[model samples]
Target: MFKIKSEVGFDMAHYLCGYEGKCANIHGHRYRLVATLKSETLQESGQCRGMVDDFTNFKKALKEIAEDFDHKLLIEDNEEGRELAAKLEVLPNNFDIVFVPYRTTAEEMSRDVFNRLKSKGFKIYEVELFETPTNSCIYTEE
Candidate 1:
């Protein structure tokens, strides 16, 4: 199979509600995301001929995702998270707030990114998210 990988980095904050640990408190990470795409055959026609996929297109898609989460506070989609976001909104101009369907964990973030790119028509092989310099998570369909 032909596989290509692209990576992007972003800074964001999040808190794991209902958890009894330091992670339950808001914190930030310099997140690094790597997306891998694969195909059994390369394109034989068009400008992308002879390549599995255009690197520029893949980078663009990854950048869009990174920009959306950059400098934002990511919270779980729950009543407590909503309340927190609402309170933040009333404050003076601050960072962006993003609500995710799952806890703001590296594993869930990887899966979320994988599904998002897959929906955009990419044959995604996996998504790797680094929550810290030494810790990371990978999500893929086998």
Candidate 2:
């Protein structure tokens, strides 16, 4: 089996709704997102003659997706958080609201990104999401 990986870093802010601690409040983090691709065969000849996969296109697409979330607020399903996000969406703040289908955690974030990228026709095998420098989560699709 051959595998290739690409990594991109971005920053975003968010507060978990219904949390009992400081995480319930608004906060931000310099997030890191890593994407991995795998394939069993390599092209015999072409621009990627010797590579397991062409990462240039992959990286470019991933970067574009990351750009949308960069410097945005990632709010989960908290009423207060949604209210604040709604109000902020109309303000001068260039806040981007991402309505996640799951809880706002590193784990969920990775899975979300993984599914999105896959839906976009990228051969995504694994996703690593970093919520903090000391904490990160990974999700893989088998």
Candidate 3:
């Protein structure tokens, strides 16, 4: 098998709506997102010959995906979250809010990345999402 990896970084804030911990309050992290792709056969011809995929294309697409989450507030798409987003939108702070389908935890973030890359037709094998330098979540299919 052949595999390649690429990574990008972003900063974002989030709050768990119903959690009972310090993380329930709004917080931010310097997130690191890593994407890995694997293939049993490499491209045998053309510009990508002998490679699983082009690194430039992989990194570019990953950056585009990460760009959406950069410098934004992630709010889960729930009733309370929707209301909060609306309130923030009208505020003078000019908050950038991103409505995510699930809680903005590292685990969910990794899963979200995997799905997003998969939707782009990448041979996505694993996603590693770092909420901090020492803490991370890895999402992959069994």
**Which candidate comes out best when scored by TM-score?**
3
Candidate 1: which stretches are off by over 4 Å? none
The whole-model lDDT of each prediction reads 0.92, 0.81, 0.92
- Can you list the residue pairs that collide in candidate 1? none
Question: Order of all candidates by TM-score, from best down to worst?
Answer: 3, 1, 2
Model 1: per-residue Cα lDDT over 67-106, one tens digit each: 9899999999999889888888899988588899998899
1-142 in candidate 2: lDDT tens per residue?
A: 7778888888888777778887777788888888888878777998989786678888987798789779877877567767877888789967668776567788888888898788878767899888777898999968
- Model 2: residues with Cα > 4 Å off, grouped in runs: 77-80, 87-94
On a 0 to 100 scale, what is the lDDT of residue 66 in model 1? 96
Candidate 2, poorest ten consecutive residues by summed lDDT: 93-102
C-alpha TM-scores of all predictions:
0.94, 0.85, 0.95
